[model samples]
Target chain A: MDLQTSKAPSPKLPHTALDRVVPHSESDWNDAAAPAAERHALIKSEAAGVQLNLGELWHYRELLYFLTLRDIKVRYKQTLMGVAWVIIQPLLTVLIFTLVFNRFVRLETGSLPYPLFALSGLLLWLFFANAVTNSTHSLVSNANLITKVYFPRMFIPAASVGAGLVDLSVAFLLLVALCFYYGVALTLQILLLPIFVLMMALLALGVGLFAAAVTVKYRDLRHALPFIIQLWMFASPVIYPTSVVPQKWKWLVTINPVAGIIEGFRAAITGQHFDWIHIFISLVITLAVLASAIYVFRRFEDTFADVV
Target chain B: MNTAIKINQVSKRYRIGGLHPGYMTFREMLGGLVTAPFRKLKSGNGSQTLWALSDINLEIGQGELVGIIGHNGAGKSTLLKILSRVTKPTTGEVELFGRIGSLLEVGTGFHPDLTGRENIFLSGAILGMRRKEIERKFDEIVAFSELEKFIETSVKWYSSGMYVRLAFSVAAHLEPEILMMDEVLAVGDAAFQHKCLDKMNAIRQQGRTILFVSHDMAAITRLCRRVVLLENGVVSFDGEAREVVKRYLSSSLKTGALKEWTNQHDAPGDQVARLRRVRVRTSDGVTTAVVDIRQPFGIEIAYDVLAEGHALVPVVEFYNEEGTELFSTHDTSSNWRRQPRPPGTYTSTVQIPGNLLAEGSLVGHVSIMSHFPATVLHAQERNAVAFQVVDGPAGDSARGDYIGPMPGVIRPLLQWTTETNELSPKSNVQSPTSAGNS
Candidate 1:
């Protein structure tokens, strides 16, 4: 339980100051005779170890909670409609996707109504997308705090994702209601819903970490991230069902992790799950991407506070 | 016993360079996204190493009050960040033995739209105080901050003074084992500043450790027992207060007091006399070292009093850096003071030192005196010289050779005023100043 040795008193409290002042002069300031800057250089540059120190993180849990809550509160503060926008954003997006894919492109929605169908995927996918994208720049955006006090740097991104969950849950209630409104029968496959949702969260976190790390070193990522996410959404099966993809290119389609998540989403709510082979492949690819994201993020984590 | 905070060879390296301008080539904005990221990838991280602190090793005993001092570009902030753990060191280690609470910048971590009460919880949590602990101290914090009525009001509407009082109150009230504050005293109005200083002293009275950084030398002298000076990312000095300040002051080499020699005397019949360069220094002009307060000192003025049909006189003045005039004197015997004078180079001096100044930079002025502020006989001033003071080694003998904290600018060698009453106990009455409303 003792975090510190018994020797030195923690120099963090204010006491009766004796004003034992020691002044240093200009000749002392320009102490070229001052020693050279030294550092612990033997650590491997390519192999920074992974440490999930839950205790330290736990010690700071309340701070984590407040910060996440702050983000959620601040997002809607001074705004019209306040929390209503949480539902409107997803609702509007569903309408746009329905128009663009179902009406114009005329993609078949099988037995499910196109609006109800796409809305579910949109709600879940939107959360994953928003959380990932926002988390990507969380650390850099809060540079003021990052540069001033010490806390687990990972909490910044993690909190952003946590805050997004509130909106996700709100938009999701409408998705659930829409499925029932469409006369879709509830299936036990819904049990697997949380699994895919989690996978989506992890997937976002991985990509987000990589992007956040890259953004600090190159601010251009700020401009590129939205474009990248937009293009990525099309590549995923959000607009069209994975079932419609031609067999010849299914290999490439399965490689995209979101492809499996969206298809699994349809099967979970409706009854048309994608091929098991593709779903498993998507899971594997998602894990691989996440591991790489963690690795890349850890490699550059120390540099973040400096440049940001 | 081991030190409370042991900084072992800690050093931080920052990258130096700017990010590449927006995406794509100069032509790419017009050409679209085709030219970018073809085969190679290019984006953000472009910086080199700028070591903020190098080979810094120090062991702070438990409950030691340490003050950090330095000029612009010095690594004082960097060192604080490292100790507080906001930023990781590129090399070395920081071994902390107790809880650390930092007030890096007031009102920085507050959310503008959040009510003052919400911000208290938020800021407290961010400062590492547990929820239960904050709940316990909640009322006391509000009472100390004197914002009970405005607690529910959002910080956006809080006046700057109100904001500072609330923010500083929260930080000061935090019962952390170690506290790190940056220039917290150099803020707000005089009354508020006094309150902060009182609170700071109270915090120290409890056996807790603290690290403070300030530009106000007098405050530093009053607050810190051991002062460390940094210059250009390195520790410049680490000794007694008076000695360090004296060395910094007397060592001034401002291009040997520039001489713009001009003989524009008698250019006009009315503006006959002209003034040359004026320089202020120690009585012994050759002793360029900083003037010591314990001893007497003088400022020198040089001028050319040409034959003038009009009256001419010279006035000398002294002012602290705050522009507060300590005192001023003049040559009432000059031509302007009495009659006219012939053409010749003349030197004038002003002298004083007996408990008349404070421990800070002083500037002097020499003006051509005339009919109630009317100039004509070279009414220009010689450059102001900076001098520092050191109180005798009498008070706070524990901080031997150090200019300990004392009230007033001059820090006079005054007698004591004291009365020892019954021990009502230090436990019951909390210091009646700002406390954290976390």
Candidate 2:
């Protein structure tokens, strides 16, 4: 008998103390013996609209924490390198770019080594790319949870973005060591590094939520996503500096929020010129994309359980 | 009596067999958008809409354990889904008074790659348990699952039973004020099922409101005092548990006491014999879909003998609602035992005496067998007819005024002889009349 014969404890009765009082009618629901009224909720069949309920999101914050932890843990479960692979992805990309650019195409990188400049930009780029790609498929992958349980559906895509932060922070430490080896002096501009990372997150979340919701209805996005991302990577200044773009075509960097953030991130780390106008424009676009993505996500979320 | 949940004028409509069905890709959807205006004239009539639920209004009081039972497509799941807020009703509102938790399925958010220990916390949080609550009762959950030895092992390697145990253990510890379960007890081994039932009973005693949806009639009748029966997206019956369960079982039976084959060429049989019709009737020979428990009923089977020179026997098998075969009766008359009938139609009937069969739905299977040099089944029909056996309030049958559920497939009234010993040293023995009255 593999079953243990230990006596299971009697489950706790939450209402035992209160039930000792005399019974009351339904009208006395707000009385002392009754459950607090704040727990009451009314569910209806109306469109969610564009209402933002921060309190509801706050209530399910623990679920977001657990889901993000699960993603991070499961991503490295079977791999031999585990967290080491997190640093390896950006390092290997920097290695390939450094070899190709330094030997053949000599695009001038200001003051700092070309390898250091590319690694700094790839830090934000890879996080944005990985976060967007993973969150895009998060809803479809967790279809079982969507149909069976009730929670903030947005947390699913949001957690994928959160998981990418763990990898980003680990890769950030390697960039710090390389900075010291290159003897690049740090300055007050480095304080703005966190702002750029925040912008990158908002942008990824905006695109991820929209794509995840759409993919639930039209699955062809799953096949077209990698190709779209490959082309998007070329448009962003990951391997090269933004200065390489001609002055007439500078509007490309202005509209691409990720390009501005990456350029801002590299500038901040190397203590170079900060593109204030471009960073400000990227912030505005990031917020707009996030707001609209949330709108489309909220509208489509009601039918996700039915169709997914 | 505070209302734990209230559902108001709820109705859900789903489009069926529509042009835009299930899911569409981006390209196909784009094509739909281009041609939608042109196709609008033919679209409305081509699609069909089905109302899964219509005008459902229910107010459940706090601390009530209710059972909901219905046949497939009866809208039980739809109602549960609405209450749990998994999907919204097309038109309705539901007000809930407390922290609502629903276990529509076990192991819904389990990650197989995570270890048993990690999954316990993850699954617990997904089921709406606070991290501190889970941490406080973590050991209890592991103990209840009985997988303490393998807590650190990945769940992918655990057997299915172990996985269900871990998932259910996390769910069992959830202390929601109102919980809705949909056939969650339909798994696991018998011993584990018994343990789960015990845990549910404990939860019920804690004054938590529970809405249980299941097809297990025995469990429904045993655990719930109130049962609701849904039929065709409407509430058909709501009251005492046993009565409603009884109604649900009999109503689920095929609504026919008689089956007939109008075309003899398509009837069931080889060249030897063919069945034409089968029916259930009382002693008065009136065909009925329901009969009294204390009244005798007959199954009449009419068939045609095509090329018969061999002796044939007609048989009828009786089964209860649970598909347990109660008894089988055959034509045993000596005159027809070895008699070979000429090519013609023959009618045979089997009489089941009063107080012999249980008070539930009974299904009859009719067949004909040829017995001469070798025994061979010539014609047979499964589920030929179904009829409900009802117990009267007078209780004159084998139940004999005892109103509780009688545990047997057949309830036969038998004679009993009682003899009191006069030479007994103990005076506690009462007289026969007194004893019988008591």
Candidate 3:
């Protein structure tokens, strides 16, 4: 390496836009009881990294927001009606599902207008699918960056979820409008909408991180993901109401936690009833999957640059 | 002084065949796999594992900018990946104090459909920059990128130059404390590249430690004080930038003359004059050669004139790493002679000078052809011997009047002009003046 650059004057003076006010030194990092070499690097890594430092990432959280915003704008760029696509997308999906299921299949929506019920589930699915797909391809496709530079591996998957959140928010408005059109009165249970959103986001992030790591090593997953996600949508109760599911098979529904979340959406928005059984089961499943995802993501994160 | 980044005994390995070209029927391929377990394990071409970097130990002090350079597959990229934490090292460790900002790629996370302004924030965020900072530098970055007019257009519509320009602008403008740039210079044209260098130079002024990589030797020589040379994932040389480039280029010279063998080896299209030994010698016809200062030297290529031909012209060309053709010479006058030495051993020697060529590796491209009805008997796009030209007395322009670095690859001996006034003319011009002093 021609280090004449070391002799090159410091970066254009007034180096203000750094991550931390107190620049961390290599020596200071070394003092931590991390592995001398690989272990040391692992220490700082988000997983098996020496330690997880939320404060450091928080300092640069603005970057995360910018990335999320970038993703949102990029999705709608060039196509007609930029931000409108966010709302139009779910609106169309709701229309299609309502036509196919409510009008044709005639699935009972349990006192809830079918359009409002379908959209509620659609909104959550969009976030999860987009997040998982983006995260799966993030490390491999960003070869230029991942191979060239390093950052927290989780950031890529997390940013995808964050970016998709903007779309989800815009799409959620349609669900609200549909509820109003159907004259479903607001209830205190609506406050719990955020908890479902968080659960969905976490679920998406966890699966997305796992997919991103696996795709780096197994290219087959790259090809398999879209089909798997499409199939996964069917497994979740997006197109139909969970009430029709036989009580005996309800346990199988818990296998796909989105089923529980979708049922919760129906319960919260319609103010009919809560599926505490499915919701509790869904939360547990989401946590198990998330912990495993983090563990797998961290395990594979170290090797990402090489494979990617 | 605190060390900003410390890497010790780091290594990275990759499985080859990410891109394999082959054909296999679906059923048979699966059947072979299924049966392989029953029969002796027939290892179908096992994947090759190559280590991109190994046993690298270095300490980067706080706010130290380092430039890394190496030949293709020399593990420079691998090292950068490890430093940036993009990939885990198979062994060894890296300890870093401050958050590292790596521009591993310009517009790495850019969504093509995204508008320039949006991509900026997105790419900026991916690089670990805050939205507010991206906003603060938004105008400046746009101005620097020279894409102010089309800021809202999707980046997919932007030309490659515009994309690179905007990408680099965002990366550098975002201002990470520790920055890593990899071949970022390869994207822009000459003027743009110069502009980028100046911008990078400006960025360096902020005391942010940086790591830059490029293929242009001149730029590398000018920008980097120290360079690391990697050979097979190991540091071969780590010191002065000039010396490392010199070492890398010099090693390219041929260690021995081309060997001669008349045995029946498959020759390209039998029409080619069977080549024997290609040698270098002095103008005096001495076999051994090294031209003294201001002395001339020649290259002697011996071959058997396998077939009769007319208008045969031999040419030699030299090139630098940047694909710049430094010089080429074709002996047109000799081709006109057409004195056929048919079916016999013949020697052709072209004389130039050892001192004339600049101090660098000069590889020769040789072509043999018959130009009667105009036919190329044998032509190799890239061929022949490489030699190193040692510096003599002349010096280069960038570092003037030195005992080294003669200007521009060739220091040809040439005549010069000076004017001295005639005695009678001087007397007439000074007639009204100093005559009385004599």
lDDT of 3 by residue, A1-308 (tens): 12433444444432332222222344432334322332223323223344444455565566666656666665665677878888887888888888999889999977777888788788888878988999788777666666655456677678889988888887778878888888889899999888988999989988998988877776778788899999989878887776688899776788789888877876777787787977998999999999888888767666666556
| TM-score, every prediction | 0.75, 0.78, 0.69
Which candidate gets the maximum DockQ versus the true structure? 2
* TM-scores of chain B alone in all candidate structures, in the order given: 0.70, 0.66, 0.59
Segments of candidate 1 deviating more than 4 angstroms: A1-54, A271-278, B17-49, B251-316, B329-353, B366-381, B390-438
lDDT of 3 at B369: 63
Residue B426 shift from truth in candidate 3, angstroms: 40
| Candidate 3 lDDT by residue in tens digits, B187-243 | 677645555565555555556577777665555665566677887898888887666
DockQ for the candidates, in order = 0.18, 0.32, 0.21
Clashing pairs in 2: none
TM-score of 3: 0.69
Per-residue lDDT over B1-438 for candidate 1, one digit per residue giving the tens place of the 0 to 100 score: 446678877766665544323222234343445745552344333233466788787777777777788876678888887777666676777777666778778865788899999898888777766676568667767876789999999998999999987887667656556778887677787656666665655556655688888877666655666778877677777766655655444434342222334555522122444556555456566433345454566656666665645455667677766777777787774444556556676776667654556666666666765663365445655444445544433443223333334345454444543332223446686343322421
Rank by lDDT, descending?
2, 1, 3
Classified by CAPRI criteria, candidate 1 counts as incorrect
Q: Candidate 3 chain A — worst ten consecutive residues by lDDT sum?
A: A14-23
Ranking by TM-score: 2, 1, 3
Off by over 4 Å in 3: A1-60, A85-106, A126-134, A137-141, A222-239, A254-256, B1-5, B17-47, B59-69, B97-103, B174-179, B199-212, B240-243, B253-438
